[model samples]
Target: MMYKMQFPKIVLIIIITSTLAVNEIRFYPVEAIPDIKKVPEEYPTIQAAINAASPGDTIIVTHGTYNENLLVNKSISIIGENPATTIIDGGQRGNAINVVSSGVVISGFTIQNGTGGLPYSGISVSGCNFVVINNTVLRENYYGLQLTNSNNSQIFNNVIMNNMYAGIYIHDRCSNNAFFENTIKNNIVGVWSSNSPSNVFYHNNFINNTNQLQAFPPMILDNGSEGNYWSDCIGSDIDLDGVGDAPFAGDRYPLMGMFVNFTLRYGSQIYFLSIICNSTISNFHFDRSNGKISFDVLGSKDTVGFCRMASPLTIIKNYTVYINDKVPIYIGNWTVSNYIYGYFLYLHESEPQRVTVMLDLPKNENPQSLFPILVATLLIVTALTIIILIKRKGKLDKNLS
Candidate 1:
């Protein structure tokens, strides 16, 4: 449905923030929070909508090839209909989208073809704070995304590859920013953060870059126990924790394989989890009633197939990992802050297998749960039998009378 909306921002008490409780996080999904103003339908171009929008308004662009250099000076969200189909070509002139305002969000678009220099980028955020660039594809540009004097932003789940100079260039006091679950590959430099520090990177897959990183010290490359996956890293996971023992590409606790971010939604709510695995995952199912989460993972026989999951404690806890109803090797579990991070080794010998993580119900188990069902069935059968006997008795009495 297309909506040409200009609704004012609604102020709800108990506002959601990055520091909200994990349970409270799922209550407010990202899609439900913003007032949408459709592009092309409402306005001809994305830049036009930005020009007409209020500070907190959201501009949703439908799937089409839009060739323009957008300059976003106001705080708003520019979301595409679909990332694979939505194209924002810069035409090799300027940055595809230049964000100079704080609290800006650009998601779900294929932004490409910026001029080949540090000044031009697919998406450039300058002097902005609390910005988010996610679920977008940035390729064939000078720099996929560049941050200049930006602070406290979250960049995740982006495919940034095949750029000329660098996939991402961060400099000039970009602090407290996080880059996670992004696949940065096939560039001259994957990440060129020369003077930037105090930012943390985890769960990202940096693959096949000519120069993987040019980061300075005091920059965190891991989340203490688990870090990113480097394609050139030759370290081994001796303890089978899905993490490398030695440092690789400036990451201390490098991951074993690519980090996959799955948006496993339950009903109206969506749950996000990061999984590092060598196998292909599919059919993610979640049952909050039973506290059970299941998915399938398939891998080659030669590769060590494993799924390392990290999520909030409210999502999955006290759970036993199973593969095809059989138990996989319990690698380990680590509690990091409000999240529960776990690793399991499930090798299927070139076959596909289901991986199930069933949380132990606080009060109910299998036999006890079955007892209630059996009792309910018995009571219903008994009631039917009494009804039949009463009918028979009434019919006989009526006949005799």
Candidate 2:
């Protein structure tokens, strides 16, 4: 005797509805939102639009000069028309732009003439989790990119030249920041850090600066087989691996010449990797899910080739690199950490070869509704159990007969 239990139809509907509701709670990234506010057309000034705009809004500033200091205290993007034509003059007053809140992006603006005293910079990032990319910080009175107590930030693809103190400065308490593909040249100090650790820097061109790198306490510069290219690195590549034979002070894999290429794609937008001082790259691909890349090209002899890609993963401690579909080898290359935006991977190549890359969606993107799946799985299992029970009961009745 097998008996079937009756279930309420309303209960099943409620369960399905609740599962759908839970899945409907979606948190979109900044790139997913499509609301864009134009400058001068929608609002008179960048700050004015910021004041009127809400979070997750984008402000596009057209080609022009804005003679004013900017203060960004909200989570938004301020994109300029072009880094060369679009300019933000500080009027020789204070920092050109001061970011006080996280989730802020300041891109494609030439920030100049931030004059005051020591510690003032063309772009001062005091908030955590911000992006300062594709901008020119030139002739600032103090630092070009200043990170004071800010953590989880990214400074990329910016020409930080002719600053008084340093091109890039990371003071105390600022950890887990990343600097890549920047041309830090002609400054008194190319890159300086004081009592700050866990900061990842690579693929940058430290060229023509008075002092290349000045860390109060000596710090490691390479993430494994990849590092920045310094114009003053006296080491040579004897084995033709494109990596320096001897350590360049703190950098282990210092390049003989400047050359690097990297790109990042999230959602539908594709961002070309920022180029540092002077170098060229051939081809590249990255597997964001596995933190690996398929490196296909290194420059021929006398040239150093590098290709890299970044993903939404924040902690990229190591990479398993593959060359021409060979066996994958694990490399503990500390590319970048908590890199405000995502994880970045780099590889050094020597010869030109056809490169192929496979990138996958992030692990957490459009997560499936677990509740529904789980309930469906349970229903199947329960039905199987009921069938087995019914068959067994029928056999028992036949035996009894």
lDDT of all predictions = 0.82, 0.67
Which candidate ranks first by lDDT, i.e. highest? 1
Model 1 RMSD in Å is 12.3
Total clashing pairs for each candidate: 0, 2
Model 1: colliding residue pairs: none
Candidate 2 regions off by >4 Å?
A: 1-34, 130-139, 262-401
| Candidate 2 per-residue C-alpha lDDT over 109-220 given as tens digits, one digit per residue, 9 for 90 to 100 | 8888777754687888884675555555456658887888888787777888888888888887787787876778899998889888788887777888999988866555
Candidate 1 ranges with C-alpha deviation above 4 Å? 1-35, 116-119, 264-271, 287-292, 329-341, 348-352, 361-401
Q: Highest TM-score, which number?
A: 1
CA lDDT, candidate 2, residue 123: 81
- Per-residue alpha-carbon lDDT of candidate 1 for residues 370-397, written as tens digits (9 for 90 to 100): 5545655555565566556666876887
lDDT of 1 at 263: 65
